[model samples]
Target chain A: TYTASALAFALRNLPVPVILVGSQRSSDRPSSDSVLNMKTSLAIFKEAPFGEVVVCMHGTISDDYVLAHRGVKVRKMHSSRRDAFQSINDAPLARVDFPGMRFKMLNPRFIARGRREDFQVVSKFSDRVVLLKFYPGMECGIIDFLVDRGYRAIVFEGTGLGHIRNACVDSVARATEEGVLTIVTTQTIFGRVNMNVYSTGRRLLKAGAIPGHDILSEVAYVKLSWMLGSYPGLDRKDYVELFHRNIAYEYNPIHKDSLFPVWSHEY
Target chain B: TYTASALAFALRNLPVPVILVGSQRSSDRPSSDSVLNMKTSLAIFKEAPFGEVVVCMHGTISDDYVLAHRGVKVRKMHSSRRDAFQSINDAPLARVDFPGMRFKMLNPRFIARGRREDFQVVSKFSDRVVLLKFYPGMECGIIDFLVDRGYRAIVFEGTGLGHIRNACVDSVARATEEGVLTIVTTQTIFGRVNMNVYSTGRRLLKAGAIPGHDILSEVAYVKLSWMLGSYPGLDRKDYVELFHRNIAYEYNPIHKDSLFPVWSHEY
Candidate 1:
């Protein structure tokens, strides 16, 4: 999720559409939903409505439709279900009717297609970025290992609302001082990443770690990779500004209803 | 999830009941669901028919009841919600009614309470264990870092069915040779960890990575700590046996329907 966002951000000024697609079931399975999903995604791609990074997948298990979820707002919810992917905190960009081959707008904020002359590709991605998921009692050596190895960026998948053990705070600070782009996301996998809400988060922020907002950890890693690769000459302040900016719909202001989609009756 | 399972497994051979309880909402909020959930959990804990680690949470959005999910089988599905926790691959142990304070049996395999004389506490836990989540392009230095630090065990939260990058396999073999209990679980967060199903997985198995079956990564970490602390003198073969054994309902064979709940119908 992070890499695509970073790539999209790096290529934000361009007119090209970047769509990420994956199959929940293997093609060999008799009950596989990959064929229909691929066909629906291809149909959406043919008349691409937006020059942005987006994810295309089966919106529902009925094989009648597919959803174009914004790249940073999508997640895989189930392990093996045909319709495991879902949009988090935001509605999908468009829903495509498989039978009629018609596209219906869902989120009006989606960008529209522009002239082909505006297209550009910046494929420079740094391989020095590392993603680390934090757990209780994780040693500081892991952070030191990354720093010592000359990694340019580190994305942490922290517990709850972006928290890591206090013991590792010094290591994070050291990495930040050493010019590593330290970023924080949550393992909760849903909800916004806000570093200002709690002390642990604030400590991380003080240590020079950037809050990933609502971007998925994987996405954050990718974003860092792209950012580091494309803007190697940019200052830290400029990089931080670009990291926080919503260049391609990576961060969404969460709505209460999005958290309890199944229990809508309660509200 | 890991802490609860470790505590439960440590106290598994005892006669006392271990109940894991948490509220989905804060108590001070007007719309908070904490009070009812707590009351329901307390009611279940008082009678506590099943002598095992079980999680008590709202069965549904309704205020009338809660479900007792086995500790190792439960997971927090949503980022923030009253009904976020759910039994991953098995039915909950029981359902408790708030008004009547009644307990209805759900899963029949729940361990029945035995004589109180069998009650015992095993508080010792090994601190030399670490949990790592694998991602693409991760450097092998992480594995080397752990091995150099004298860590006795590692539980890898691998991508897809318990598979890691091929580059890390040799380090895993080295860890095994140095007497570290290397284990593999899936980052998918659902489904079994089957290393034999794929070539990469088979390679990991050949490198001495033990498949954690259906155990969650966090739970696997805790189990390893507890197992190592309790049986510090055991041989590798016996350690592997204990790792695979269903010590405290951590490895339940999955049911098809459990993967897709009622909300799946909408999808």
Candidate 2:
């Protein structure tokens, strides 16, 4: 899902359906999902009207349908389940019934099929960016390592509404001082990251860490790479403004609550 | 929630319930959840059984009930919701009804009330451990920084099914060689991380990352600190074995499919 989303960001303004598909089980296995996933993806390619980057995979354990998830909003959830890839923080874009051979749109917001000539590819990506997941006893030296190495950006997968330990705030301040772009995304995986509610998060924001609103950490890394690679000369303010803007449907304005299609609603 | 869980692990074998409570809104606000949360927590303290470390918080948007979550299993999911703290990968230990003044044990697998004399405190903690989240372009130098600085452990919040980039495997190997314990937990936040399924994960395991089976990354860091501090002279094999064992019910043997209490049952 991260690779697909990164490709989507790199290949901007797609004019045709860019469906990324993969099978959880091997072809040698009797219960392999390869054939069904391939067939469903073919069906989507032939019939779907959207031209956005999307992932098509088994929608349920029973293999009755395939869900077309927006590349930026999808995640591989379960380890070895056939239906491992699921849309996160948002509903899937479409669904294709296997037995009925029918296609249906689940979420109407999508990039419609566009002209073939309008396609543009900004494929360059920066490898200097790093992602750090902050825990209680995380050392401040890791941030210093990246800053000293002249890295372009650092994305923090912070805990609970986007917070790093208070001890590391000065390190982040130093990173920003070195002109490194620091962004904070949540590790909760289901909720939007708001760096304004608590003193810890507020201190992080004050230290020049950009709050990654509703953006998945993986997608944020991909987007940051694209921004750094595509526009190398932009000022810090311009880069942050660009990073916060909704590009390729990465930011969801409203946070909708949805289950993983199997959990019971009992909290 | 992380602090509560760390305390729960450090203070072993509770004989009486230890209830931790907090409010989302300030007391000055009319919509503050403080009073209700406090009253419900007192109710649990005065009447409830099951001697364990638990977090008491509002169960839903309404002020009807408060949930008692196992301290080690809970996480602060939302930024400011009254019911922000939730039990991840497990059910709440019990629920306290506000209107009826009734207490119900939602999950009976709790540490029952024991003799008060059996309680023990092992609160020593080391701050040398770090939690690094792996992304596509993460620099390997960060691991080297920790290992060179004589850090004791590295808990990696890896991608789906517990994987770091292929390039960083050698760095992890070096960390393990230096007697720096390396552990891998999932960023998925909902599923058990399996290093046996994918080649990247297999390589990470071979590089000496102990698979953090069904343990939240935050809890993993806390447990590692406790191990390092409480039992100082243990060798690498002893530490790995101790880390894998379920201490203070941190590891959930079964992954329950429970929603966040409010989401609709739709994928």
Would you estimate the TM-scores of all the predictions?
0.89, 0.93
TM-score of chain A of each: 0.88, 0.96
Clashes of each: 6, 1
Instruction: Please tell me how candidate 1 rates in CAPRI terms.
Output: acceptable
Which parts of model 2 have CA positions greater than 4 angstroms off?
A257-267, B256-267
Score residue A265 of candidate 1 by CA lDDT: 12
lDDT, candidate 2, residue B87? 80
Query: What would the per-residue lDDT of candidate 1 be over residues A70-173, giving only the tens digit for each residue?
Result: 77676665555566666766777777888887877777677676677776666678889998888777878788888989998899998766888888989999
Q: Clashing pairs in model 1?
A: A1-A219, A2-A218, A2-A219, A2-A220, A2-A223, A3-A222
> For candidate 1 chain A, which ten residues in a row score worst on lDDT?
A258-267
Displacement of residue A202 (Cα, Å) in model 2 is: 3.8
Clashing pairs in 2: A133-B133
Q: What is each candidate's DockQ, to 2 decimals?
A: 0.33, 0.42
